[model samples]
Target: MSNINLKTPVDPKDAYVLVVEDNVSNFVLIARLLAFMGVQKCEWKTTGWGVVDFANTMSRVDLILMDLRLPHEDGYEALKQIRTDPHLQNTLVVVVTAHGSSAEMHKAREAGFDGFLSKPLDADRFPEQIKQILNGEPVWDLGI
Candidate 1:
């Protein structure tokens, strides 16, 4: 297990992240994990609605950690919106969900999510996953 420091320095502010999760506790946990992984700038949205719009407005959002379930549009819908947009199509999205099942994983893959993380997110693995994504590696671990 790696020890994460919540105050590491990131290269650029524009390398921000968007965390779309309705649960406050999950949000906090993810936010802290991001901070520890050297991602200092992040935007939090409780609902999946308007996520595409928010992401579009940003100059550079390196990544998005989206929850599968939300009050409004679900992460699948949100991911579709993001992927459909020409401007935001290249953005990386990682699905974070408590419902970690083969079916959900398949759906996320079909929805074009860059990665998937099962909650409760392991603090050690969380940072490593983020690092892998940032390094231009395929975020999904579809173990054969």
Candidate 2:
């Protein structure tokens, strides 16, 4: 992965993030953003099923950037599996999708997402949103 810095004053290398998006463009965008944020440790999974498998193999996963709509399985189902898994139950998951709505946000919350971000995600605010999640803040509102 090419080195990119997304954070202004923060170094994200110390942090680890897993981005689960089926869309290649979206995955690239997320990976770039994380790199820009100074996140040196970032992994990618193209499907919900892949995410489950990856999570099982990973020793430490700090955060998960999950796409709401995906082939094979949706984010909701994947979230359910993650939450139910004894080992991964505590992993923080942030739902990322273009289908942003009050209902969807509520559903995400119900599914136990740690946070939510609308698609076409603002690169400018991406770092802050990540920081907020890491700080144990729930960013249910896109206004964050």
RMSD per model, one decimal: 6.6, 6.8
Query: How well is each residue in 1-144 modelled by candidate 1, as lDDT tens digits?
Result: 111122333343336888999999999999888887678888899988999888877776777889999988999889888878787777778888888888888778776787888887888788887877765565554332
In angstroms, how far off is 134's CA in candidate 2? Answer: 1.2
**lDDT of candidate 1 at residue 86, scale 0 to 100:** 82
Q: How close is candidate 1 to the true structure, as a TM-score?
A: 0.85
Each candidate structure's count of clashing pairs: 0, 6
Q: TM-score for each prediction?
A: 0.85, 0.87
* Residue pairs clashing, model 2: 4-35, 5-36, 6-36, 6-37, 7-36, 7-37
State how far residue 10 of model 2 sits from its true place (Å): 12
- Overall lDDT per candidate, in order of appearance: 0.77, 0.79
Error of 2 at 30 (Å): 0.9
